[model samples]
Target: MTKEIFDDIFGKGNSNWQKVSFLRRCFFNDNGITVNWRANTPLIKLWKQAKDLDEFKVLLKKDKDAQKLQFTHEWLKTADKDYDQYLASIIKETATMQYDVWSDAGSVKVGNAQFSFLISHNNGDGHAIAAVFKNEKDFISSPMKFITSVEGTFNIYDYDCGQNVIVTLNGRYDVYVYCGITCFVKK
Candidate 1:
């Protein structure tokens, strides 16, 4: 499709027209027949509002979302139906079917300070663990460190003074604070 035709349907300078044009080329081959087809007003509006290809695909999948757009050509309608089915299959294949549940052990107190812990699975080889201090006072203990019992696995820690401390650990680890307080872990 030419830029002139795209501009006519979706107004000038639309960022998504190139992507839409590419997808149209993949789905529809009848350029001559498409030339005679009028712009579906509701569809044009929806296309203009779509921020990206992903959002446009989502809009196309929802019947209620594109209910106002009337398909004027048989081939255009067929292409849209095929694209929707393709999206559904791809979504099903890539969907996250299971999630890891981490048990919480509340906060641990170390001397005058208390810390709340959170652990997130990285979906790969490691987990990101964060320890947030409950109070606004910095841990005055110099050279604060996170000690884990797992041999050969080291902790990469980032401390934001009195705010929070983050550590990335590989595999299963039992982490403890420098003050001998055990942090929460996945149960």
Candidate 2:
């Protein structure tokens, strides 16, 4: 299911594993239609006054046109060129969407300590949470309760690591973290 959607959004061109992993992460949500990514720094504000997604989209389009837009997709196009821009772009773009399920692919340096994750549940119906953090040391936190779904579609989770940490998913699902700056693969 996810593999097909991945092919659709990003065609079968060059097969870069990191690129493939990152793009696959974008469509991990339940509906498998949206991509949500969080910027390293905050970007343009979605008109808070707007009541719904439709209204938000309208305001977003307006805000973008007014040149009120900030560094939205620049990270995708030119994220620290010294590193893997291809992998970086897809991760950044995926983090900006609103969805029930989504994940990201990334890597950390040898001395790096932790990786942050943004998790969210858009649906109102209560669903028991199930998340796993896998690496040299693995941990799983499951059945976390979300009594009520709120306005903000995401929350932060950090995995403290000894060596290096890699990618993060936006849910309590099992994922992989690895060493090096470009070595996150979801299993």
Which candidate ranks first by TM-score, i.e. highest? 1
List ranges where model 2 is wrong by over 4 Å.
1-83, 96-171, 178-187
99-127: candidate 2 lDDT, tens digit per residue = 22222322111211233333333222232
lDDT of 1 at 72: 17
Candidate 2: deviation at residue 65, Å? 27
Q: Which of the numbered candidates is closest to the native, going by highest lDDT?
A: 1
66-153: candidate 1 lDDT, tens digit per residue = 4322231222333454543343232233222211122222222111123333322222222222332222121111112344334232
Q: After superposition, how far is residue 147 of candidate 1 from its true place, in Å?
A: 66
Q: Candidate 2, residue 80: CA error in Å?
A: 15
- Candidate 1 lDDT trough over 10 residues, lowest sum: 134-143
Query: What does the lDDT read for residue 78 in candidate 1?
Result: 38
Candidate 1 clashing pairs? none
lDDT of 1 at 103: 22
